[model samples]
Target: MSTIDAQTDSDATDVASRSNYELIIEPRKGLQLFDWKELVAYRDLFRFLIWRQIKVRYAQSAIGIGWAIIQPLFSMLVFTIIFGNLAKVDSDGAPYALFSLAALLPWTYFSNAITDGVQSLVSEANMLRKIYFPRLMLPLSAVAAKLVDFGIAAVMMVVMMIVFQYPPSIQIVALPLAIIVMLITASGVSVWLTALAVQYRDIKHGMNFLVQLLMYASPVVYAASIIPEKYRLLYAINPMVGVIESFRAAILGTTSIPWDLLGVGFLSGTILLITGLAFFRSKEKIFADVA
Candidate 1:
C-alpha cells in the first residue's frame, strides 16, 4: 500500500507540473523591431488578404474594373479643360492630356492607397479583436491592391500616347525607378497614416481632405517648371515631385532622366519609410487595446 501510494503521489505531481504552464504574447515593451521571420511564416495570410481586397473592391459594382480606367481618364479631361485650356499649363511640348494622365496614374494610385489604407485597421476591428496576425498586413495589402488599378490605367496611357503620336524614348529604361519611388512613398505614408488612424479615428475622416490638398502640392496638373528654378530642389522634397516628373521624363521620353531629382526624392522617400516603420512599430502595441 505504501509503494502504491508513493507511485500515485509521483504521478499526480508529474501531471500538475505539465498542466500549470504559462504562455504570454504581446507587443514588446521597448523598441519594437519587426519580426521578419514571423511575417514570412504568415505569407499565406498576406497573399489571401491581398486577393480578398482585389475581389471585394468591385464585387457588387456594375462597371467593375472599368472604374480604374474611368477615374484618371475623367480627371485628365477635367484637368485639360481647366488647367491645360484655361490656364495654359506647360506640358513640356507634349499634349497636355497625356502629360496630366502620366502624373495622374501614379497620383491616383497614391490617393487610393491612402484612402483605403487609412481605413484598413479600423475597418477590420472585429478581426483585430478576435485574432492574432501581423497588423502590418492590413495596410500593406491595401496598398498592393491598387496596383491592379494602376496597371489598367497604364494600359490606357499607352493607347493614348500612341493616339497622340508620342512614343517613348530609350530613356524609358528609367521608368521602373520612378515607379519604385512612388511605391516607397505610398507605403511609408500609408503605414504612418493607418497606424495613427486606427488609434485617433479622426485621421480616417480627414484623409480625403488631406489627399486633395496634397494633389495641388504635387505636379499632378501643373509642370514642376512653373516653380522657380531656385525652388526645384526644395520642392523635390515633396517626394511626389520626383515621382511625377520622373514618370513624365521616362514615359513621355522627351526629357533626359532627372537623376538629381530622383536622388533627392529617393532619399526623402527612404527617410519617410524608415521613420514611418519606426512610428508604426512604436504604436503597434496600442492598436489591439484601442482598436
Candidate 2:
C-alpha cells in the first residue's frame, strides 16, 4: 500500500474508534427518573460540591461552625423552660432538655438542609448557567453540608446525655437508621422545594412558614406520647415524628421501637423521594433558563 493510503486508512480507523467512544448529550423527555451512571461518573464533582457548601456556609462568620452547636442548644434551653417547666410537657421520663436536644439534632439538620437546599440552585445560578453537571448535586450537596452541622450538634447531644446521666443502650444500634431516615426525609423535601423555588421566588418565603409549621406538627417540643393513640398513626406520616421519636428512644433509651410509626415514616419518606426526584427531573431541563 502507498504510504498516503496507509495513513488515510489509519486515520479512518481512529475516527471509527472515536465515534464508538463519543458521548451524546440530549434533552430528556418526560419524567426521566435518575441518571445513576452519570451521577457515579461525576462522583468527584459531587464531593467537591459538598465540601464547597460546608466551607462556604461558615466561611466568614465570626462564630463559624459553632453556630451549629449554639442554635440547637439555645433552642433546647428555651423549650426546657417553656414546655418543660411551664406547660409541664412530658419527656417520656427523660430530662426535657435532653429530650428536646435529641429531637433538635435531627430537626436542626433537616430544617437547615431544606432551607439551604431550596436556595442552592438559585444561589448557584452562575455555575448553573456556565457549567454542566448533575443538577441533583446542588441540592444534594446542600443537604450533605448540614451533616457537618448535624455531627457538631450531635456531640453536644452526647454531652447533654452525660449531664443527664443517660448512658447508651443496645438500641443505639438503631441510631444510624434514625439518621438515614432524617437524611432521606430532608433530601426529599429539599428536592421538591429546590425545584419549585427556581420557578417561584415566593417559595422561599413559603418555605420558612412550612418549616415552622412542620416543627410544631412534629414532636420537636413535646413527646409523641402526648399525641392521642388513635391519631398517632396520622402524625407519623410527618416522617420527622418517627425520626425524632426514634432518636430519643435509641439515644435516651426511653420509648419502645414504635415500629408502626417508624414504618409509616419510612414509607412516606420513600414516596416523597420518588415523587420529588420525578418532579425535579421534569423541571431540571429548564433550570438554566429559569434559575
Cα lDDT tens digits for candidate 1, 9-116: 999999999999998875467755577987999999999999999999999999999999999999999999999999998898889999999999999999999799
TM-score of each: 0.92, 0.91
In order, the Cα lDDT scores of the candidates are: 0.90, 0.90
Query: How close is each model in CA RMSD to the real structure?
Result: 3.1, 2.8
Error of 2 at 149 (Å): 0.8
Candidate 1: give the clashing pairs: none
Poorly placed runs, candidate 1 (over 4 Å): 1-20, 26-32
Query: Tens digits of per-residue lDDT for model 2 on 1-291?
Result: 999999999999999998899678788776568899999999999999999998888899999989999899999989999999999998888888888998898999999999999999999999999989999999999999898999999889888878878897678888888888888999999999999999999999888899999999999998889888899999899999899999988888888777777889999998898999999998988999998
| Cα lDDT over the full model 2 | 0.90
Worst 10 residues of 1 by lDDT: 25-34
